[model samples]
Target chain A: MQTGFLKSSPKIILRFTDYNSPFLGPSPTVPTATTASPSSSLQQPQTWICFSCSYSNFASTPKCELCGVKRPDALTSSSSTSLSQTQISPTPILGEHSPTASLGEVTSSPTLQPVVTSEGISCPRCTFSNHPSMVWCELCGMELGTFKIDGMELSDDGNVEKTERAQHVKLAFRNGGSASFNNKLKSAMTDREWEKITEPISVNPQTDFDPVRGGISGIMKNVAQNQEEQKETLDQAFKDLDALMAKASDMVKLAQSIKMKLNKDSSESEVSADDDSTFSTYLLELGMSNPVTKKDSGSIYHQELARQLAEFLSALLHKHKGMMVLTDVYCLFNRARGVALISPDDLYKACSLFERLDLPMRLHQLASGLLVVQAADHNDDVIAKRVLEYIRQKGSLTAIELAAIENASIALVSEQLQMTVSKGLICIDETVEGVRFYENIIINYQWDQQALQ
Target chain B: MSAFDFPSIYNFPPFFTQQPNEATWQTQAQLWISIILSYCRFYKIHRLDLSDALTTELFYNKSINRRLKLETLQSIIKMMIKQGLAEWDPPNKKTSAFIYWKKPEEWATSISNWVSENGLNNSIVTLYEIAHGEASEGTEFHEIDQAVLLKALDVLVKKGEAQTLQATNAEEMGVKFFGTG
Candidate 1:
């Protein structure tokens, strides 16, 4: 676990090189960083207190120059809180430890002011400052600011106390100096599971060290294993598409079979014809992949548009009782065009051109000022008969109600009603509520009776 | 507006408004003319007030919640006058109309027949008796307008079937019908 933490440290001892570099120093910045580690990544001057001389000592001094005794504390004066309480000389001391006695001998102060590094970070455990750019502590090879190492290692081994070396290495790894291959792969899958898992692995040869180089051989083997599975699926899809393409001629054969069966019209064969009708309907929907547009037919735009509209509207007219509002046709036509939308004027021009076209559609203007495209087969008499039938069921009908019955606008219904009234098929009633239509009752009127005898 | 006396077409709301189309309006006008005649005949109402037709029960059709427009009412009345079934009583404002549900000739025949049935031929009878008298009470002419009654009498007098006699008062003018010979 500690070795994992050392993965991100900036520097490594010559002997610990194998344990540290996972990317084989492929990045040029990684090798130079270790050589320049002492001055740039670490190197903060500190002062320590001597136990025998009762004097402040430079942290670099191994022994007190005044009493020839070793400095007892491993940490600096500020770091060891109990160092002053342990013992004092009990007398005024002099020698290299006393500033007054050696003012000239020392020549210059060895203590450096604590630097306010605007860009670099100070190591939290050792308190030795480190460059913020460096991900690990250069002095102890500790992972700098490694939160995951603390969480993952502490969670794993709560009872086992970490050794100094293990703790230092653990700090480096958790700070994200160089993540393990398994950890990187695990995190990569967190986003898009399918794509990230299949994506080729990228390596930064500098900080990642030997693992990038060492892990390549292992990764290739895993990829080869996955390649076999993907190859089978592609081959299966290709086989299915090829099979469907081969059977295209078979669809026409089935249609021909139904045409033959339709002639027989037996009660048993009617079921087969119904099935064929559904299949034919599906085939019809597939027929209109290529639509005529201005780019396709140029100056013949209105003429071709009119022809195409006739085919589309004939079906729509059958659905809407042989007539539909012009505005509704505009919406349906533009929606079918997808991206290339035509204006209302364009649709109107196309519909008007239907006069010359073979299509049996006519633009009719109702007396109430509503425009509609109606099939030629549905004339005024047919509509009047329908209106009469509707009245027969409902007894009497208003313009709005009749509009709903005929799937037309109220204005169109009103105009149709006016025509029906003129034809003597119906009569208009103007009441306090609104206008309504009823059956014509007056049949004859010329007969006058002679006075009673 | 009594249901008993009202025609079925009176319940039809469209009958109140005059149609705009020539063919439709012609048929509708004829229908209105017939309804007005039958309605007047049933109620024995000889005079029709044009302004009152809009607000009064005759034209204020409650079932349809509509009223005949004054112009449409006048036009229909004019049609009746052209057909000789009605006449403008005062001829100036044309405000009031005298509806002849029966033409003068028709009334003359009806009254002449009444005189023969009652053995009153060649006998003197006051004009008031022929109109408001008890004998005429069972007929449509009972309480008929004086002008219409004089017109009916003039039709008989011109045919020489009745002769007018001098009366002491205008209301008591008398008529004598000749016996069949």
Candidate 2:
């Protein structure tokens, strides 16, 4: 029953039965109780079949079985009847109820398998791919000492070496140094808890630990000192500001007092004093009279001051002819006092008196005109004739020009002109430019004209 | 000699002071009013500048050292305008004033009457000959400022007393007195 010198094994016997049961081929022999089939041995080598459903399979499979499909007779035959006849010359056959051929996809090429890495895996922490024998994450200084591969540490010596103090210090420095280490130590042991606990036992020739607690205490002392200094500086600044404000307020009050004094006195008298005081004190740093301390000693001084002021004012109006700036008069008033006697209010009163007495004052008129104080009411005909002759000679005379000629004020010239006019000897012509007195009686004197006729 | 009578004691200095007092000033103004006008007419002063030298002698009289300022002169002139004794000439500040001791119309009437009385009415007269020439001899029209004579002539022309014609010289104009009465 052997074919081509290949012996049929027991395992090949099932494949032979599976190939014959389906639509792959008509059996040259059928499985029967009556006879042991010799051709069945030869047919096992030729037929490839489905292991699951007894269908014909391909020859390339290592073992004959239903791979993925479960149906009987689901394997494909290449459709070569001649090769089938050669392999199974005396073929065993299955009955007419055998299953159909398979419709599954097939290809000749095989799929590749996955390869395992040779070196150690990259660390999830620092991503440094180190040797599997190493017990720590090298780049990030992570302790991988506890790793158990098949219930044993990867390197016993490597784990032991890491526990040494020098190695720990090296790693600590690399991981943000002694400062970070101290912080971590402090966080782990709070101040209260550390106080309750025993101090660390001092070891000789220690590099990492500063055996005394001085470093931390020194840092805390420096921070406290800095905070104290800042507080002192801020307090000093506030003190300076308060002093400046006090000075400003004092100045304001003084100004108000002076103003009140001016209101009570005359505004005119204050004007001159104000100018002189400012000039004298321009570069001075002190004694700017504070308003709070000015003493107003009632109205007695005011009366005395007013009388003197009136006299002074009356004199000035008689003396000066040009427009007098109020400030000049104030300076004179302030100076004449043996002491700082007149208040701003009194100063103001003096000016008002001057202004009020400008008109209706007989003294003012005499000062202004041809009538000398020596002869206020008298018309000095000598002066009148002189003026008349001068005008007669000059044809026109201004107030000043005439005053100069007659050796008198405009007041006197004005007086003489008025007297002359009243006597019907002259007439005045006034215009926006100036006044001119004409000889009316002299022109219309009629004696010569009457004689001519 | 009556003008020599002194009215009161002359010791008051303010009497020499220019009266800022309006009533006193007004009285003062009125007094100077007549004096200035009369003096102007007496001197034939149709124009007055009121210079310092003139004011010195006229108002002060040199008996005292005090005098009126240029400002006082201006104030007096302003006062004079109120009384209608003076009119300001718009073109000249110093020269503007005209004293109307007699109005322009009256001067014109006086001239016409004089011409008629002299039997010279209806005569064609050269303006220069009438004002400055022999025809004006011993008359008020003699040697008048040209402006004043023209103003008088214009008044006469308006009154139908005269007519004017341009003359050969620029300033020599002619006047013809037309009225017989």
Candidate 3:
């Protein structure tokens, strides 16, 4: 019986101890069993023994009533020795007697009789007995499997308070089983406290929390810190870019100094003239010191851009033989400007302003609608005379041959040749050998006498 | 005649290709007109077939390997026709044209002069005898194309200086000339 109580006590303790209540009922057998030693119990002062069943009886009874056998002194002596042995182990004694003591108290006391039920679980919240198979109270709807200590007070006061909130139920066993149950329950509570103390220590370091860092506030703080770090990295990248730009400007200045020195020494050196001119042109193309930008020039952007463009292209136009296609100029101008690149529309508008601004380099549109930048000195009349001179010198000249001689593109040369043809200074022969230009002889031919012959 | 002397411009490559500019092309057209008239007169070529002319040395320059395109030659011929220097031979078809180095009026004056000089005024003369007879040999009108001779006679008839006697056969046609009254 003691072994059975020990086995069953733990299950009841585990279930009931979920509620942390200070009012866990005390063990009724603990005080008495501890104080009354086994030697004192061996005296067997007031109780009479039943030999057949080894049952303890009241002092008034002499027979072994459980089996109807007569009580003998030898059997009484042997039973007393066994009782003393059982009393030496206090848990077994408590387990053996506590159930019978609770049962006697249940029968003798009228107060507890209404609270105790014969079958099924009783809800402490309403004292409603639910069916054994039901997990919740049928009347109060309190959970039946677990006891809630909060409901125990209402039951103890015997005052039923009805509220809209769901009520928790406390369990109270009436068969003295609660004494051993409370003992096991107290031991489980201590074990839970031990776990609670060691839980933080066992957590992984990444999640381990100090008093200042634990919940949503901590995560928000970390996000803010990460944003600060990102801003700093972005600022560092911009600083590096600024430093690179400064170094680039310094290099440009050095190249300009070298070009100045080469120009000063150019008259004495013959071999370096070509190299020096090209190098100076390269330096000139590196980047303009102050390129006209929309931000800087604002409303007069195109006008200022036109002036700057004329200044920039004047030298280049001479190098390219006084003409360049508009697209090629756009590329070269943007390359020299470096950072402030202009769109095609902007370049066109700026070139259009060349006539209004009276710049040396004007935008020239060919018969085919192809736009070109030509030096102001390189007009149709001058180009016609140049072509006429070449044709007169060579007797006849194709566009390709002139392009090779002039070191200009065939398209530009051909356009010049056509302009000359339009001016009546030169004529073209389009044959299987391609278009060839010749001096205008028909204009000077004496028609009257020539026709008469 | 001594081999016809070609103008220096004839050897020019651009002369073989038509010009594109308006003023330049007009000048080029005049040059071509003079060249064509002189060339036909030198060769005594009364009619020019455009396709056959394209391959001839008159239109193609073998030394320079440049040939005047057909469309350009046609345009030149059209220009000449506008000036009465040339006429489409079959009239409606443009494939061939008659080049008048000496126009019918000029040929009529030359024939009237020849008749008066021969003292044959008011005398009927067969058109074939004027064109192919030994007496008319070495004359400018001698061996002239029959069609051109008839055109020259028609000019004289319009001037009231000559009258044509038409026969059933075209070869036997005759004309009587009168001294210009």
Candidate 4:
């Protein structure tokens, strides 16, 4: 592992013994003992010279352990300057009777006094040394405590335990030029907005209502007031409208009955007078028409029809036996009830309603795992055709694909697919590749016909 | 081959990880599964001993220098198992699997119908004949794996529509009949 270039260069080695030791400077102008010191001979020099850094240190040292600059020249040099700066400073002497210095005052003073310790932190800006625990520097008046200090030794194992137990302080700002402790920082947070207020609800004897006495008294007073008012205003208007409605309905029935009688009376007339007679009467009374009918009783039949149709279609899509894609159902319902296009919300409500019915319509996924709806009276042939066609063209499809195609991702596609799969409208085809859909749904297919053939 | 030159992208380790995106991962996993299945099928590899050789042919990724390790191979097989594509022969046989690109049930049904259609019902046929003979020519059953065919036959036998016997100690024989049951 030796470098090729280093082998060609000449090597040098030196050994150190004391402060006056020759190894401190290269090409030492001093003599070496060259032999084992005789025990009775003069004791070796008490101090030593560090050969790597030229610094004076304790003698009888076997190696320069701090600089780690090995004495052997064969060792390649480490590029770092750590080996050249090991200096041992002499202990500083305390000056007695110094001006502006009191023994107790200097030790206890706290305001921005930089005290250097082994765990001292150096300010990057001012180079003022301070203990790591100090928040501000004494020399520069600069804040310095928040930084992370490294390479400092702990006095005891208790320091490690103390640091481990210390909690991080969280500071929060408050409005109106003030700040206070927020207890929530120390407690478990709730998964709710802070502004939500809880009010205490209490049962009070003064506020509770009595139903039996209140019901009878309230209805009696209301009935008396209505009776007195009915003689003059609102009730009379309804009474008059009721009489008019009866007359109008009677006229309609009389007209229908007359038309039926005329048709029955005619034995073999070539062209019955029903068409022109009804038309001419309308022409004669066109300007002088006084058609009297009560306008109040509203039309509920059309509304009931739409509601029934929506309910029926929803049931057809969701019932257990039938399975339809919601999109398909939407299209079919809209087409069948021509000119009556249901809104998306109504379509959704209908699906949920029918899902609640017996044998809920199940949503299913295709072989490509696309979403589809299955109604109770499911037309499997239609589903099989559509799903097969999709898978064939796309190679594969996911629920999102089916949803995009259907244009309604939320209501019809997801629920119906889940339902149909649960009900086995489709079989999940898993390959080493991934799950897919397959049309192995065992409905009443005529396998017997093929077998007989 | 001169130590198989690895593509630089193979050094990009993400290529070995199963992607999280559904479609992307599905396609990637499927492609790897298909490639491995086809390689194993062609090589008649029942067990993959990854330590045996650093053969680049098994994983021919030209653009990436990295190749599938044994663990990654097992993961791909596991993905296939999830899709019902292959099954480990046993829990301990993580390195060996019986691939069912068409599952045993599917194969059984297909074979039974093929037999009934060809009027091979109630007739005995040798295992070799069923796999490579003229009768199975141009069909999915042609050159079928013997162990896979045995499992399919075992399914049919349990259903009472087929029975199996050894025509010789070294030979396999099976008979089937289309039954209403």
Output the number of the DockQ-best candidate: 3
TM-score for each prediction? 0.49, 0.30, 0.59, 0.26
Query: Evaluated against the true chain A, what TM-score does chain A of model 3 have?
Result: 0.45
Task: Evaluate model 4 with DockQ and give the value.
Answer: 0.01
Off by over 4 Å in 4: A1-453, B1-14, B17-27, B37-58, B62-64, B167-170, B179-181
Candidate 4 chain B weakest lDDT stretch, 10 residues:
B1-10
Candidate 1 lDDT over residue span A308-411, tens digit each: 88887787788778888899888776655543567888789899888788579988877766789999888999988988889878878998998887887676
Name the best candidate (by lDDT): 3
TM-score of chain A of each: 0.37, 0.21, 0.45, 0.19
Ranking the candidates on lDDT from highest down gives 3, 1, 2, 4
The CAPRI quality class of candidate 4 comes to: incorrect
Off by over 4 Å in 3: A1-251, A261-273, A447-453, B178-181
Output the number of the TM-score-best candidate: 3
Rate residue A346 of model 1 by lDDT.
78
Indicate the DockQ of the complex predicted as candidate 3. 0.40
For model 2, the superposed segments whose C-alpha errors exceed 4 Å read A1-453, B1-17, B52-56, B90-96
User: Model 4 Cα displacement at A435 (Å)?
Assistant: 32
lDDT of 3 at A170: 65
B101-166: candidate 2 lDDT, tens digit per residue: 556776787778878887887777776776778877877667666776788899888877789888
